[model samples]
Each structure stands twice: as C-alpha cells, then as structure tokens.
Target: MYRYTEFDKSFVKSRAAQFRDQLERWQDGRLSEDAFRPLRLQNGWYVQRHAPMLRVAVPYGELSSAQLRVLARIARDYDDPDPDVYRVASAAQGKLGTERLPTHCAHFTTRTNVQFNWIPLEKSADVMDLLATVDMHGIQTSGNCIRNISCDERAGVAPDEVADPRPFAEIMRQWTTLHPEFAFLPRKFKIAITGASEDRAATAWHDVGLQLVRNETGELGFRVSAGGGMGRTPVIATLMREFLPWQHIMNYIEAIVRVYNRYGRRDNKYKARIKILVKAEGQRYIDDVDEEFRQIVEHDGAPHLITPAELERVRASFVPPALHASHASHASVDEAEANANGHPLFARWLQRNVAQHKDPALRIVTLSFKRLLQSPGDATADQLDIVADLADRFSAGEARVTHTQNVVLPWVRASELLALWQAAREAGFASANVQLLTDMIACPGGDFCALANARSLPVAQAITERYQDLDELDDIGEIDLHISGCINSCGHHHSGHIGVLGVDKDGREWYQITLGGSDGSATSGAPQPGKVIGPSFSAAEVPDAIEAILTTYRDAREHDERFIDTVRRVGLTPFKTSANAVRVNEEVSA
Candidate 1:
C-alpha cells in the first residue's frame, strides 16, 4: 500500500479546498448549475436522482486496511439520512435500523473506484476531505479527462508477470492528474495496462491499452493500442506500436492522446470517443501519432520525460509486503484441506473464489460483492469494516479491488484458506460464483442514477436467483452476462457474451439483448462486440429471456464447450430464435 508524503498530502488538501470553494460559489448563486457542471464532474460529483454521487478513485484497485476503514467512516458520516430516500426498496436494499435506509452504502465500481450514492451536494467537500486523509481522491475520475489508470489486480504476485505494471501505472497517474492540455478532450478517456499473460484488466475495451513486454535482449517496453471503447459504437483498440522503449512511454502516450484530442469528433457527443477516431481515421491516425512521438522524443529531446528519481520514488511506494515464502505442505494448510473436504460448501467456495498464488504456499481469495441476493457492486458501511478486518487478518493488512467489482486478497496463506473462508462466509461474502453468470456486473440504474432508462439492480437479482443452482451453473460454464440500465455501457454490456441493455419504449422499461460479445479474454482473439438479437423485452421478461438463452446454448453446444465458445461457434440464430420466442410469449401474456 502507498502512503502519502508531504507533497502528496499537500496536493490533495489544496485540491479539496478548491472544490469546497467551487461548491460554495454554486450554492451562493455566484455560479450557475451549467457553469458548475463540468467543475463538479472533474471532482467526481454527479447530481443523481436522490442526491449527489461521488466517485472516489482507488488507483489500480489498491487499498490498505487503514484506507478502507477510512472509507467505512465516510460511509457512516456522509450519506444522506432523508426519510424519502428509504421509501425506495432498491436504494435501501441494506437498510439496517428502525432503522436504516439506502443512504450510506458505498458501491465498488468495475473501474476500481468507490461510489457514494445519495450523498448531499453540500457535503462533497467533506467526502473529499475524508478521501484526502487516506491519500485517495476523485480527481480526474469523471468528466472528459483521462479516468483512473487500471491494471491487473495480481500485478506483483502473479507468477506469469514479466514486470509489475504498478510503478508505471502510478507514473502515468501522476502525469495525467490534471494535465491542462488534455483535460477537456472530445469525450472521456480510459487506460488499462497489464504485465501478465491473463487479461484481467479488460485492456481491449479501454480508450488506450498497454501491455508490458520484454524484448529478445531482455529489455522491457510497451505494446501500445489505441481506439478501444464501449458504447453505441463499440471497438477494440488497434495496435499502434509494436514495442516502445520503457523510457519513452510518457511522451508516447501524450502523443497518441494529443492526436485523438486533435481529430476526435466534437459535433455529436455520441461520436466523440477516441474509439471513433481510431475507427474512422484507421492507419493514418496511427501514422500521425507515431510521427508526433518521433518529433517530440528524437527531435525535441522529450521535454515530458519523467526523471529517474521521480520514477524511482513512485516505484518504491508500490513494493509488495514481505511474506513467508510458499511451501509444498504445512500443518495449517493440511488441516484446512481436510476441513474443506469434509465441508462440501467450503470446498465449493475454495474451488470458486480461490486461485494459485505466485508464492507457492499462498492463495488468491476473491470476495464477491455480487452475491446471490445483493446488489452487484454494493457494500454497506458495516460490510466495509468486515472487508477491512478480513484484509488485516489474512492479506497483509491490504486488499486490491478487481475490475469485476470484487475484492482480492492476493497474499492469503493456503494454510488459512478454510479459516478465511469460514470467516468470510459468516460475513455473507463467500458466494462461490467467481466469473460465473451469477457473478453478473450491473450499474446503478433508474433506481438511483437519473441517467438510466430502467432499473438494473432487480434484473441482476433476478438472474442470480434464477441461477442459484451451482450444478446447473457449472454445466453452463464461463458466461459473461453484463446488464446496463442504458447504453452508456457502464455495465459493459457491449463486451459481455450475453449483453442486456435497457431502453425506454413508450415510457415503459424494455431491455435489448445482444449475444457473441466478450471482454476479449474468453476467446483467442480481440473481443467481439455485442450485436442486437431481436425486439426488446419488458422488465418482467428479462429473467426468462436470459434463461432461454442459456437453455438454448446448453442444448446446442458441443461437448466440453463453454457458453462463450458455444455462442462463437453457433452464431446468434439459435439463441436469438429462442429468446425472441420467450419475448413474444411474454408480450402476448401482457
């Protein structure tokens, strides 16, 4: 975990003070809502249906126990306590008191950020202050700026890692913090990086994606890609550079974003993403960016270079915790294995949430926020404390958030696996549904966010309830089902194998389905963007429609094929036909 130094602390305190002044100006009518909109967005404040939503960035999904406890404190203090907010059951799903409302819950986002929904607009500064105390902030988390830099959750401890990407990710985070030149680009931008063989960060769907690669001579560099994003026109970014020297990454990235900022569309916001620029301009865009990089680095001597000392300082902050090395077998581990064998439920949890660690005696334990009966990415204030305690007990007093909206304890000992599982289960977090259909991703839809066309949380719950049978889920293995209340793609429906997008049809909520999409890791190719299946379904029909698609795949799939593989092999005709039938039958019944 990274601690704040004097300079870092000063920067956050100054920024928080600045935002507080901005909020006061708006309240005093010195600044109109229109004038303050962009400023507020830059600081991660959005006026939602019930109240303002603040997205606090958790860089690369990393957090220490102390920082998480601070977040729990914020949740307890900052959330609105209005009586009307509790009237809506979805928003108040975890109501705790005579009680409680949906007021203080925090959502862990798929982008590795935490969102405080229902926070009062007046208290945005308080939220900022809490985050600043823990070396966190919402700066550049929203708006048209480059959002948080995401990387593999298993960055340092993965055996397959060529080199940890955290140091470079932190370097980029600092450079792009508030770069005046690119802050108000055509539209929002995102970046994902990985040094691992597995694409856990979903690199292909970001505006800019980078992979750390080692050359034949064993020198490390980057393979840069541009134009990737998800929305109305989803695209997997094109590979722009085969290999860029490690020292040149700073300037090289500046050059690519500069090229996109120059030529990206401004007429229609729909066509404003860099993905559109990459798709429209094709190879010429890549050529122009390369030429710019050459001029900046070779001709002008790279004025934007990060000095070695600065790089080393940031790099040193990300060192992994010291741990006892892994072992083949140990007393605690052997006892745990025996206990797991006897307890079938614990065994199931081990098979699902646990993975092999780089340290042979250690294990990777993923805690699911998308449990069978809860909101996809939400955790109550108390739940946050539970997470903090679990991290302290088993994972070196630190935890990492995953892009899948789950928490990762990357350094838990295998010897303590059963004990950890039992503790997590007692806390209602041992869901045993990692990367399965039950582990669906969703956004805060019409229930909380004013931007949504329909409610997303209920659909996720319906699917989880409909598919609670582990045996059946195993039969239909490896399904990426993403549901978004709107086409903003916050739920990443465009990249899901079974994509569900919500639409407003004649003032009623309807869902559009898409099949054959993936986050690019399921298959041995660039991710396939989703395509519309047929007519939309009403809210009531969504669960059955999903069930029909799964059933069709089960019947039509070849031996040993995953759901994604089946969809790829058979195209959308069979699933489409069955799903449309379900849709029609429901419409007639209505």
Candidate 2:
C-alpha cells in the first residue's frame, strides 16, 4: 500500500483546515446551505434520509490494516454500535444522536480512493485530525469535481497485467486532485485504469477507462475507452484509441476531459454525464478532440519528459509486499478440508472466489458479495469491522476492494479457507453464492436515493427472497440480476444476465428488462432493454415477475447452459410471456 508522503500529508492538512473554517462559518450562519453545499460535497458529505452520510473515497479499494482499524473506530464511535438498533432506528433519533455527537456511518466502498462517513458537522475538526494522522484527507472526493482517480487494486501484482497502472493512476490523482484547469466541469467526472487481463476495474463503466496492454511490438500501451458512464443515459463506452502508447495515455485523457469540461451540458444536470456528451458530439468528434490534445502535448514536449526514473519513483511507492519463502504450501490443507466437508457450496466458492497469487503457495481470497438471499454489495458496519479484522489476521496488513463492491483478502493462505469461512459466517458475511442468481446488484432506489424514480432495493430484495432457498439458487447456476433505479444505471443493470431497469410511466413506476449483458473479461457491453412489461408491480409482485422469468429460462435452457447463453438463444419473448403468465396465475390463485 502507498503511504502518504510529506507533501501528500501537508496537502490534506491544508484542505482539512480550509474545510474546518468553512464549517465554522456555516455554524455561525455566515454561510447558507446553498453556500456550504458545494464545499461540503467536495469533502464527500451528503445529507441523507436518516442523517448526513459521508462517502470517503478509498482509492481503488486498497487500504492498510491500520486505516481499516481507524474506519472500525469511526463506525463504533460515530455510527450505531448495535447493527440491529442502527438498522431499525428512527431517522429523527439517528440524526439527533449523530448531531449531538460526532457520529458517522463508516463505509468502505469500491469507488474512490478514500473511506468516508457521516460525521456531525461540528466534529469536522476532530475528523480532520484523525485523517491527518493517517496521512489521508478528503480533498476532491465530490462536488461537480474530478473525483478520485481509481486503478486496479492488483495493479502491480497481477502476473497477466502489462504494467503497474498505479504510477499512472497516482500521477493523474496528483494532477487532478485540485487542478484549476478542469475543476469546474459541466458535471462530476470519473477516471479508472486497469492493469489486469480481466476487467476487474470495470473500466468500461467509467467516464474514462484505460486498459493497460502490451502491443504486438512488446511496447507498453493502453486501450482507451471514452465517454463511458453510469447515469440517466447509460452507454457502455466506445473504444476511442485502439492502442495509445503508455507515454501518451495521460495526455489523451487530459484532452478528453478538457473537451467534456468545455462543451458538456451544464444546464440539465441529468444530461451532464460524459455518456451524454459522447452521444451528442458523436465518436468522431470526441476522437478529433482527443487527437488535438495529443498533438499539443507532443508538440510542446511536456508529457514526454516523464522518464523512467520518475516512473520508478512512483512504482516504488506501490510495489507488492515482501513475502517470506517459508510462507508456502496450503494446498494440502485445502484439499483435506474439501474432502471432509461434503458441501459442494464451499468447494464452488473456493474455486471461483479464490485467485492464484504471485507466490507459488499463497492465494488471493475474494470475499464475494454474490450470495443467496443477501442484498448484493451491501454490508453493515459490523460486517465491515469483521472483514477488517479478518484481513489483519489472514491477508497480511492490507485488503483490496473490487469494483463489484466486494472485499478481497489478497494474501490469504489456501489452508485458512475453512477457518476464514467460519469467521465470516459469524459476522454474517458468509453466503456461498458467488456468481449465483441471488447475488444480484441493485441501486439504493427510492428508499434511500433521491435520484430514483422507483424503489429498486425492495424489488431486488423481493427477487432475493423468492430465491432465498440455497438449494434452488445453486440449481439455477451463475446468473447476474442487476437493477437500477433509473437509466443512470448506477447498479449496472445493463451488464447483468438479467437486467431490470426502473422507469416512470404516468407517475407510476414500471420495469424494463434486458438480457445477455455482461461485464466479464471476454465480453464488455450493455444489455439492450427488452419488451416493456407494463406498470411496475407492487413490492409483492416484483418477486413474482422475476420468478416467472427464471422459471421460463430454467424450463427452456439446455443442459449446462448459463442464464445469458439461454437468453441469447431463446430471446426475451418467452420470458415476457412467462412473466405475464405468472401474473395471471397469481391473480387467479389469490
């Protein structure tokens, strides 16, 4: 993990002092909510339904054990101590308690490069102190700003990767942290880089996705995808540069950001995402802008001087941990455990969720979020603490967060699988359903998100509940059911084997389904919306619709066929008919 240098520490301290002063002004009524909104947002604070929520960016989902311990402390000190009490408590009480004290909901997510929580407005100073100690700070995490630049957590270590993208990611982070050049963009922009053969970073969903690849000539390069985003208008991004050499990647990205910053729509906030810009200007126009920017950088001979020495300096900061030669051979224990435990569930999880490591004997264990009957990508504060502890115990002194919103203990031994599973079960993190149908991704919809047109979580919950039976879920095999509140596709509905998008029709919520979309290494595309299914169902009917679709697929699928392959071969008409059939059957039964 990259420790903050003296310069980095100084920068954060300065920003914290600035924010503290801003808070004081707001307290004295010298600054109105309107005046403070942008300032607070820049620090990743949002006033949510229950209380103020702070989203701390954890750059590329990599965090030291010490940083995670601080997060646990934040959860225990600021958020509710009891998970049950916290979940059901009244908003007024929660807010009152949080307001009276410096409480916050400590959350670790795959987005951004920092961890954030909802702390009391008054405690900004204290929070700043805690951040300073860690040499971490919230500088450009929010606002209509260039948010944290994300890169693959396994950037330097992945054997199949072209090069460590962390150096590039770090350079971009430093350059864009608070750069005045493109600060006041039309809307928030996101940038991500991946050094893995697999699209673990989901670069396709970012405003700018860079895939680090080696060209045919064995020269380091990048495959750039531009205008890709998740928002009201979802576009899976188109390839802008087939092969941009490593040296020119940053320049090209600067050019794209500049183009969007200057011409992207500002009047309608809904249309401000880069996806819309790509659509309005066309790919050719965006390409021209990128070319023009590249020309300027090349002509000036500015970006060219970032030599091997500078690259080495940045690389040294992100080098992989030193492992001992003695830390080898957990395969025997893993095999023995599997033999004793007749549960194929555990075996399947081990096979799919674990990754091979650089060390011959060690393995990278992924704590998969795809679990039967669990809300995809959601973990309570308690669960967060538990995972943090496990990371310390098993995965050296650091952990990795996946773009899929799951945690990865990237240095666990294979022998510790059973023990780790036991601990996870105690913490409610064990649900042996990685990649199954029940591990659906869903947005926080009307229940929490103000941007939602319909409630997405409840619908997702309904589907999970319907398929709650572990045996049934296992039988169904791997299927992705992703739902988004609106076209923004925040939940990545467009990339699921079964995609459910929520929309408003005549002031009532309705769902549009799509099939065969995927966000895997081989396939990178958005799922096209299928036939409209009429007015959205009540919370109870949501499950019924999903069940019908699944049943239809189950009946029609060939042996060993996955949901996506089945959908592609048979089309959505049968699923549509089945959904209507289920609706009619339920009405008659009722």
Per-model RMSD to reference: 3.0, 4.2
Q: Return the top candidate by TM-score.
A: 1
Whole-model alpha-carbon lDDT for candidate 1: 0.84
Candidate 2 lDDT tens digits, 1-590: 67788888887888888888999999999999999988988877776543555666676667777776666666666654333333554242221222222133343344634333345667766676676677666666777778877777566656677777888887777777777866788888888899888776778877888888888889888899877775556577778888887777667777787788878888999888878878777966566776777676877665633567877887887765665233656665567366537867666666656666665556677676554444456555556667778988877777877666667787766666767767776776667666677666776554445566676766776676567677787788888777888776767777777778877776667677766677654333342333344444545666777788888888999997877778888877888787777667768889
Error of 1 at 97 (Å): 18
lDDT of each: 0.84, 0.69
Name the regions of candidate 2 deviating beyond 4 angstroms: 80-118, 157-159, 324-345, 369-375, 504-511, 520-535, 586-590
lDDT of 1 by residue, 341-400 (tens): 799989988888898777778888999887765788888789999999999999998898
Top lDDT hit? 1
- Candidate 1 differs from the real structure by a C-alpha RMSD in angstroms, to one decimal, of 3.0
TM-score of 2: 0.88
Clashes of each: 2, 13
